[model samples]
Every structure is written in structure tokens, then in C-alpha cells.
Target: MAQNPERRAALVDAAIDVLAREGARGLTFRAVDTQAGVPTGTASNYFANREDLLDQAGRRVYTRLAPDPASVAHALETPPSRELVRHFMHDIVRRVTADRTGYLALLELRLEATRRPDLRRTLTARLQPEYEESIRFHLAAGLPGDRSTVSVLYFAMLGLIVEHLTVPEVIAADPIEALIDAIVDRVVPRE
Candidate 1:
């Protein structure tokens, strides 16, 4: 295994781009190597196998997309209100739209997971924490609704994000901000 954490992270980042750009079939170590502009077999030295690479890519996607803690903390310090929730949803949309490739890659992983139980398990393990953390954040924010509400909001936002990112034509007719406001209105408890 590579002792250089930076090198390993770079390989993982490259793997994410390959997976997103080429899909699973094209996500070879060689592909990652090319993407990273490193010598051939550089990815192999860091990753044990395809599953390992996929796992790292999946994990990397989340880490890359995670919200800045400072921002989250600032928001948390503010009074918890439906308005705050709406602001949060807007931020979500902004972030997702900004990094369409990363989200698209994550969508690819979701499809790949269906065909491969091992990959599914790997992704589930890597992604389940997102849900847990979301719940924790909601609780800390004193946001209304039980876990189920958070779950609903999560899935709804995910659906909107998926559609917006993948098929702009499907929903481009309507303003996304309006749509997000609507979602937040329905999901978050009324102040």
C-alpha cells in the first residue's frame, strides 16, 4: 500500500472523475492513472482491487461534497426556523448544481449498486452516515419534525437534485428556487 496519504487521495480523486466520466465499466486503474496524469499502475499501488477503488471513490464523493463546517456552525448559531430550513435547501441546490459531475458520479454508483450486491453494501455502508449526520444536524438545529420528516426531506431533495442535474430539460421550465421553496415549505414544520 502507498504510504503517501496525499498520493492515495489524489488517486481516489482521479478515480472519482473516471467513474463519473466513464462509468463503472471504464473505471480501470489505468483510466484513473490517466486521469490523474500519473504513470501507469500508480492507481493499482494504492488500491487493492476494483471494489476497493469503487469504495474509495464513493467515500471521496461525499467528503468532497460535504458542507463547510464553519458555515454550518454559523447557521446553527442562528435561531432555528422554517426560514433557516429554506435557506439550507437553497444552499443544497446551489452546491448540487455547482458540482454536477460529482453528483452524476454518485448517481452512477447508485445504478451500479443495483447489479452488484458487494458494491451496494459498500455504498450503503459509506453513505448511511450521511443520513445519521443529517438527523443529528436537524436535531441540533431544533428543526421541527421527527426522523421521518428528515428522511422525507432528504429523499425529496435528492430527487429534485437528481432530476435537475441529470435532465435539466425535464424541470428547466420551472424555476428551481421556487421548487426548492415549495419543497422546504412542505417538508419543514411551519414556524
Candidate 2:
């Protein structure tokens, strides 16, 4: 079907709002239409099914959350070191916290993906290249450790992001950037 990119993008953004606010069970075409303030059936017309809507929403969230190219390039210019990793980690925490709703929507997509094989496949495919890029960046930067270090750092940051976003009280004692720096210090290995 011919799709209006602007309308489709709006509906997908509306879907993100619905996912973040209502959770996966509440993410329906009607909810997205309502969130977008469009007439009923608008979302359904744009998205063939829930899976397609979710896939688009997930991609949108990634696009919104990914680091800026200029910032990444600047960081890449510096040699990879513990300080560099900490800087990037701090940037990530700031970005996620700044766009908490988007990240939460992504978390909702992750949960939805667990139950839906199609979504799981799509999300996994979407993330594979990012993971590869991180590995390449680490190697190129000459960071210590290996892919396993990258994996550990990824999951640990993810856990921190989840906790920091959901239950601020759980980590309220430590400053977020400090906590991120500490985590990066422990995981990235010394130069």
C-alpha cells in the first residue's frame, strides 16, 4: 500500500506514546489513533498490523535515542581510554534520561518482542548491526578487553538504565553520571 511518510511517522510516534503510557497490552490501533488525535482507523490504515506498528515504533525510538554523529565523531577522535568510555557512558545516561519516554517505549517493545516471534526477529535484526558497530569501535579505539567486555558493558548499562529510569529511588543516593562513570571504570578495563 502507498504510505504517506509524514502520516506514517506521526502514527508511529503516537504508537510510541501509547506504548510508553499504556504498556504493551494497551497498545492498540485505536489507542494510537487517539494518541495521535487522528480519526479512528488512521493507525490501522498506516500500519498493517500490531507487529508492523511495533517494528516502526522501535525503529523510531532507536533513531531518537541514538547518539549524534558529530558527538560520536568527536569522541572517536580521542583515543579509547577509561576516560573516553566514561564520557560516552555519561552521554548515554544523559540521553536516555532526557528521553525517558522513548526508552520506556523501547522497553515495552522488548517485552512485546518476547512473546511475539516476529517482533523478536525484527528487533534482534535491528540491534545486530549496532552491536557489531560497537565492537568495531572498541577495537578501532584500541580499548582493552574483547567483545565480551563490550557485552558486559552493554548489559550493565542497560540494567543501570532500567533501574535509573524506573525506580530513581533505587539509585537516588549516587549521582547518575558518577554511577555511570563507576560502572564504566569497572567494566572497561584499565589501559
Candidate 3:
């Protein structure tokens, strides 16, 4: 495998784009190289096989989608209230929607994971900590909800996002921000 970190990261990013555009079955070293604008076999040198490429793409998507540290810190500065929770949820939707390709790549990873047990385990392992941390943050920040609230909000936002991204016309009449506010209103208790 190549030792150049920047080049490797670029390949993984390109792989993510390929996965989003082509799905798992269409991901290939040649396709990745073409996407990355690198010479043929460049991706092969960085990744051992298709699985390795897919795994790296999955990891990269999370990295790309993670909330900005500055934004998180700023959110923390505000008193944790139902309104704050709404803001955070809105931020999540905004971030995901802004990075459409990354989210799409993540969706591809989820679909691919369904067919591969190893991938399912890998994705579960990767996401479990983040999920737990969200719960912890909600409690620690004095947000007006418990684990169950956060869990429901997570699923609800995920469904909303999937619909907004994949078939937006289905929900075209409803504003996404309003839907998010409604979800937070229902899930988190008022002060």
C-alpha cells in the first residue's frame, strides 16, 4: 500500500464519490482512479481490494459528515434547552443536505452492508460510539430528553433525510426545517 497520506486520502474521497454515483457494485479501482484523476492502478496500489476501498470510503464519509468542532463548541456555549435541541437538529439536517454526495455515499455503504456481514459489523462498530455519544451529550448538556428521545429523533431525522435526498418530490410540499422543528418539538420536552 502507498504510504503517502494525502494521496491515500484523496483516493478514499474519490472512492466515496464513485460509490455515491455508481453504488457498491460499480465501485472499482479503475473507476476510483478515474474519479480521482489519478493514473490507472493508483487506487489498487493504495487499497488491497474492493472491500478495502469500500471500507475506507465508509470511514471517510463519517469523517466528512462529522459536525464541525467550532459549531459544536458554540452550541455548547448556549444553555441546553428545547430550542437549542431544535437548533442542533436543524444543524444536522443542514450539514447532511449540504454534503449531498457524502450522505449519498453513506447510504450506499448502508445498502452494501446489508449484503456483507463484515461490512455490517464494521459500520455498526463505527456508528455505535457516535450514537452513544449523542445520548451522553444530550444528558450532560441538560437537554430535555433521554436516550429514547434521542434515539427516536435519530431515526426520524434519518427517514426525513433519506426522503429529502432520494425522492424529494415526495415531501416537496413540506419545508424540511419545519419538519425538523416539529420532530424536536415532539421528541424533546418543553421547559
lDDT of 3 by residue, 82-111 (tens): 999999999988888888999999999999
Judged by whole-model lDDT over C-alpha atoms, candidate 3 comes out at 0.91
Put down candidate 1 lDDT per residue, 1-191, tens digits, no spaces. 43689988999888878877889888999999999999998888888899899888888888778788898888878788888888888888888777777888888888899988999998888779878888888877788777887899999999999889878789888989999999988888886
The candidate that wins on TM-score is 3
Model 1, position 112, has a per-residue lDDT of: 90
Q: Which window of 10 residues has the lowest lDDT sum in candidate 1?
A: 1-10
- Cα RMSD of predicted structure 3: 1.0
Q: Comparing 1 and 3 by lDDT, which wins?
A: 3
What is the TM-score of each predicted model, taking all chains together?
Answer: 0.93, 0.94, 0.97
TM-score of 2: 0.94
Residue pairs that clash (backbone atoms under 3 angstroms), model 2: none
lDDT of each: 0.86, 0.88, 0.91
- Give the best candidate by lDDT: 3
Candidate 3 lDDT at 60 equals 90
**Candidates sorted by TM-score, descending order?**
3, 2, 1
